[model samples]
Target: MVNEAQEYLADPVLGERVAAELRALLRDPNRLPVLVLATLWPVHWQRLTARRDPDAHAQARALLEEGTRIRVPDSFTAADAHVLAAEGSDPRLRRARECAVNGEITQYLAGVPVLLQRYEDATADARALLDAAIDARRLGWGVDLPTEFLADAASGYLTRAEWDEYGEQWPAPALADTDEHRGGFPGPLTRVRPRRRLRQTAPVDRPACRLADAVEQHGRRSRADTFPAETFWTASLAHADAPTLITLAESARIRGLYRTQMQLLATGALSNADAAAELVNPLTIPALGALGEVSRWAASIVPLTDPGPLARFLRTLHSANQKEAIEVVLARGPGRRAELSNRFGVADLVRRLYDWNHYGRFPESVRSAASAELAALLTRHPDGPTDTGDPKSLARFVNMLEAPAAACATATALRPRSQPDPDPSDAEADEAPETAMVLASRLKRLAEAGNDRALIDLLAEKPARRVAVSDPSGVAHLLRELTRIADTYDVDEVRQLSKRESVTLIADRRPLERVDLTDPTGVALLLGWLNRYHGHWTSWPDRFLHRLEHRRDPLYLSLRDQPYRNAEHLVWQWERAMLGRFATRAAEVALTDARGVADLLNTLSPRTFNYCPQPVAQAALARLLERNPAHHVPLVGASIDGSAAEVLIRALRDAGDPEAASHLQQRAFAAGAYPYLRRSEYRDYGLLPDGTWSPVWTWADMVPSY
Candidate 1:
């Protein structure tokens, strides 16, 4: 049909007549199967419509409208491009496929080269408009540019002479060109419709556009060229939200545009504290190889504004081990180091620099300078290192400095010259392993230096003496020193001095009163030590058991959570210590109170009962039953189960409780022994396949009937 109507399509009147018949055929269901397709240029379509006749216009609209309009996409997707490339045997398809990039023809991929070509050839006004659009996109804010903003930005991009030539009528065409509608897709700039749904703050639909993603990528890739000097971006983006500024700031930093990055970050910092803190971002610091312009820009913002941002920025540089950057920044404000130290603290300053220097990053000169600075800081303090509240850290800082005067001053302040010599017999002092380690180290240094007074002062502290007990190496050193003193001095005078140093008394209390059960120190010295190191000190168990029986110590009842194993071990040790003496401390303590009986019985293992003397075992069992008669059956059953039935029966008989013993035996025999005798420990007592008691364990027959 297109072959027949070829000549008529060229003629306006004939084309209209032929288009009318095709439009009717399109509506007909029977003929619709016969597909009809056509293409027309925008210019050709415009020429075919009549300008003067209403009827001609109506006929023209009908012919085109009733036809199915199949529009060709302006660009090919990745898949379409690949298919085109694979089938590039056709020259036209091959030429079109050349335009594809990254397997697809993106708006930017197609448009940027054309825009660049246009930019090179275009007159001043067009270039101005394009420049404004590029800068806005390069700002790295989100890609939503209002047409009005583009116009304003473009006006700002124009010079005085250019603006004079085209003031209100800046003769640049609309950003979305009409040629785009005709399938000539020029890019790096494209138009978009406004999104105006509910909760959408986007403005009314008009000419809204954005630079293609390629534009920003291009800007970042090409950093050698000069960025625009116009302040229009600042004024236009002044009210931009924090997130947008942060994004732009990050982009600026990546592109080595430090001034731009700081400007964006500074603006964002006004409303966001985190953004304020972010001014310390390592990339944003001018001292770390940023351009001179950036250095100047930073100087303008920091030290001149709030010192908090500058201090944080300095700390970050120091933390990253960037020594040169710290020096450069500190050099900016001569008093910056001292000012920051005063504001935060010398302790914090020492802590920050200590971690860096501890790893040995700085040179000797740099370390010496840091030390001197710290020493000077110490001098300014009225009380030296003591004022810092962390003498160990301050002392360590000065020691690392290796400055003799500063180290001495810190030591002197730590231990005053006028400090009263501590009471040599004070045993009530608490012990801390950490503090002891530090003091012990200091004492060794002082003793090596032959600073007798300083060493004495250090030893006077209670924690200092703890080193003698807790650390073997420390006690060895103390013993050697004492041996040297004993050999060098008169023996009697040395003995008197040693007697004064001995911690035999507590305050004014004598040695006997010191370990009294009611005294907290004495209680801890016995029980706490026994719990942790029970077997190491055998004497304390006997002393502790003696106190348990004789002493009126109410605090013993509060001893909860003490390790039962430790109690068992303590009981065993107590028995060993008591064998030489006349009294059975365990039995005596069990007879004291109901709790004491339970405590004593609970700690009495079968091993202890088997090994313990008969009188002691009888005393414990009788006391347990005397306190609570109901304990008799379980006690007898426990003895049988533990394979110590002989011990329980003998103890019962010897304790003058034969009737109680006989009743217990009858209960065990009535129960038939199988249940209680199943324990593996009872295998040695006696065994039979029928689970009956052996003769050795069948004490019911041996029990003399009362």
Candidate 2:
């Protein structure tokens, strides 16, 4: 049988030699010791097949069935049977059953409970595997499968009691439940309900009300609340049959609430005179009227574009019984009828408007309107600049005109009435320069009085001295004037003034050259003025440079030369020092004279070289080499013993002198030379007693060749 089993195991056809030997071993009681080894044979073969083959299910199934069906002794207990049954419970162990039934386990398990238990276990295992797969997927792996297995497991696990408890606590479908509706315990399937559709509704529309209707309604509500009050009287007069809204507005001015009435009228909602009067009456209260109600009334009349009504209304206010009403009409008329330059007595009214306090901060619309009228008057009548006779008004007029018109008006204003055409035969003709000076003096006085127009006026005369002379030392005063005009007047005015003044001052160059550079205060002031008013210098470079060059007093020289002085001065000195050094060097070489070389050398003190040591040495050496190359040899040797040797050697090397290289190496090896030079390339040249060059080994030469 052993031979037969060996043959059978060797046979490629049946391939049951190992199985036959195992059976023979089981049949012999003497070979029962082999059963221990035989018992592990199927396990060993299964493990081997699992390791070697991609699919081991068939092999594992064959091994399991062969081991199970092979008869065992009756000495085995129920525990052993149970252990075997447990082994069969494994899906891997059931591979034989699955293969025998072609993956259908239905015919293998006759007991329903056993089948059900196995199915439950398999379902649970499937769920566990799915859970692991989901976990892997969440960690960015690529596993995907239907959720049916999870649904089956969840349904199978939900007992009646469990379902009741789950329903009581959660009462909602678990996210894991994905099955179709089933008749088991209430799962997600039975609880889900269908959705219902919703109905639609329509939108409503309405008509819009006119602004006039809205204002009338507001006025009616106000009147009802204040019945038996003066507002009722005002409202009644507002609705009276006046020819225009301006008439009603004039009538409302006599009543108490003209301010409120005017506000309503200005809303552009009043369709008739009566409504305007009602609006204007509330604004006439003394407290309300004085609160600048007329300004608002005037603005309200603007959109009406019928200046005739506004002009007539203002005339009525001017003729009103109250003095305050007259004052308001006169003072606020120009701003109100700003577009009507030809209105009766409007210029006088505009002049009166200037008298009102705080004109600068007037409503922008009012100021804009007033500016237009004033600009027109100034344009048409050059002589009638302003009716007010106030210098500020004239200034305001000049400020409003175009440049040419302003210039013409200023010239006309500044010329003395008699001086329009001066008599050449007059005895005072000789005093013309004095007269011009006096005119300049008067113009400056006007400027001081805050009359930029007068200043600009006198400037147009081209006074003998366009620049007003206050104090020669008062540069601060001059700066203040420039800054004042720069800040307050237009740029062209400032520029014209500056140009005329610059020309006037050009004759007396003393002011330009008289800077006290040594006086710290004067220096600081001058520098600040220079920097602040640098724009003024765009036309005066030669004048500025002249002052800088000619002012060389001890104070000026010291300040100019100080290293720790102002940054501008310091920068200027650095440039000057560099130029002076270069110039001295150039003279020393170009003159081909020993005196020039001596002069250049005399300037080379330790202090001079220390401050600008490199450039100073370079310049000196360059001069020496160009003048006389031999003259530099002793100097280079002397420098080699001093602190400037390296600088001197670099300068010579840059001049392409090979002797400089030989001298540098010799000096590097000299006694008490720079210790660091022992490691430098310059150490390779040694000085010979006969004054000849010789090569010497350096530490670099000792390094091994790569």
Candidate 3:
């Protein structure tokens, strides 16, 4: 009953009311500061002004003054008369007076009430999300939170690896009940946080010294005066899983607990070995000053002595951990020159540095050293660029664009192949593969500065299309000023510099502005850019429509040979719109291509068959009927079991149009006028006028490879 009453009194709002009543007694000059302190939290009194407060020493002395050092209660029970005198028989009556006195000046009224109680009231999922957001903000991890936080809150739970990796939402699965929906209990291997491990309550302020301790502990009005997070991190580290330890290291990084983070970094047994990399992001992780002596040697900075405790600590690590630990040393330019080579081959270390380029947290000197070594490796001609990675990695070497023209060319040459968090408490790890974020930022910055030369300079640097798509948040800001961004380069320059990825991104995903298309350059660029995927005949149509749908001009109709034939997959309903537009094109122009003929067959108004006004479709079907199976590829994008032209031919023949049939037979043996659906070298051949054999191709075979 007493515990329940104490919890009720702990209510922050009620605590404020009780504080006012205790402070009101201070107006009686007879009251000793010591007695007054016993009845109220020192926080309220510290903020209060006494008459002698103007002088610094006087203020300090007055704040801690005692009346002749009289003995005070070892602990003040609220039942004591000193407190009960100010307390009221009715809680409501006391609240009404305190509320009337404080009025607008109260802390509760200063801002939206964000009491910790509200955080507790949130659902597990919501609380996790809130905690993750708060953790990310405090840790300085970028806003792009991990996927765990993004999953359906009701179903997914953050894993130890994920939590340690990204610091998503907390509850750590082990801490929460086994929801039937989320499988059985997490099991014995799961490390559950102790319920009361991190926080300790001060024994409810007892003697005069206890109140003084509260004042000392509370420090200034600012929360920064307390190193409470230190305790939070320390408790977390003692019990955290390998993944969670990384998060603790990150917290230590935030708290300037460099020594603590360094100790953690020396441990290689972490569930995720990458924790060491995260701990010392060069600038954030300064050179471990004076635990050991560091001196400069050429471009290499070396520790003259061992890195103090870290040297002994390295012996305890696994090989991988030892490698990472030494790399951290080498990266900080502290260890011997060949240390990286000894631990990881020189070539391998270069690749690790390349990976770190994506991190963007490495010190400039470290990054420069890595880049120089990589360049030197390339210069030696011992191994080709392909020795490191594929063209895709080369393409997306986040800093590849930041590289000078020569270095970017090297990365471009190497491009082709592209390439788990354990901490639940850490909730959010750094943004995974922030390459998009990094590239987008560069584009945004370059675009803002109107550096057309630099923007165009990126024409040489390329990544895969999906990889090149900028982050939505970054792109949103980019698009808001796209017109200005577009103006940075000439319209012709855009076409000249545009990669297949960029053309598709603007044409489909982030639509180009009307002004960009006014010259018809961007439209043509979109069309040409689409030529890269002709190999996937089934998908090419979808790609074309997807990429061209945003084009203001209906130039698709004007093209003599449209590559895409599938309409069922029309994402933007462009098939219907394009068919409607096709009604206006000349019959000869529309009939030659299989897509044109197939469009006509499916789009015919079901209500009427006689004198169908789709003459282009009608003529095209007649022409196709003339050709035998040998004359066309067996199947095109629009073709059913029979070829597109063959299917249409049957429909026309069934319609019993003699004029069309006569026209079909008259030219039946003649060479096909349109592209074949399924042409092959074996059947798709013709006799030359000179009587020698030559390959014959439908019009599609003739469209130049862009």
Candidate 2 deviant stretches above 4 angstroms? 1-300, 303-343, 356-373, 380-706
Where model 3 places Cα greater than 4 Å from the true spot, the runs are 1-225, 229-231, 238-256, 267-706
Where is the poorest 10-residue window by lDDT in model 3? 206-215
- lDDT for each residue of candidate 3 in 1-706, tens digit (9 for 90 to 100): 1111211222223433343343334333455342422333332233232332112123222322421222334333435433434765765444433442223212222211222223345455544444433332232222233323222321223445555644454434422321111222221111223233354663322111011122212222222211232323333334334434554454443333444454444331232323433332343224333112111111122221222222222222222233334344445543233332221133334445455444435556655654554444444433335443354644444234324323322321111221232432222213212334444455556666767677666533542234333333333333333333433455556433443434444445433221121222222222222222212212235545555654644544344244443453342234333333322221222133433343333333232322223454455334434432222321221211224444444545454554553343222212222222222344423322112333443323321220
Per-model TM-score versus the true fold = 0.27, 0.15, 0.18
lDDT of each: 0.43, 0.35, 0.34
Residue-level lDDT of model 1, residues 1-706, one tens digit each, is: 3522223453324455566555555545565455565665332344344353113334454455445545556567778877867766976456546864544354434455555555455456655655666665544444566566666767766778878887767533635341143236445456676566675575455566666544444543232122443344554455455556765565444333444455666666555423443554444453334333333333333441233334444465454455665555444432323443233234445554444335557776555555554454555644456443355856665454434323222321111123344542322224322432344345345545666554344444433233424332233233334334433434444433322332211111122222222222222222222222323323234444444445433323333224435654654544333331211332333232222233334334334444445565456555445643223323312212433333344445454567754554433332222233223442233322122333333222211220
Whole-model lDDT, candidate 2? 0.35
- A best-first ranking of the candidates according to their lDDT comes to 1, 2, 3
Specify the highest-lDDT model's number.
Answer: 1
Name every residue pair that clashes in candidate 1: 111-187
lDDT (10s digit) by residue, model 2, range 71-143: 3342334465446557667773354343423332322332222222322343332323223222212111111
Global lDDT of model 1 = 0.43
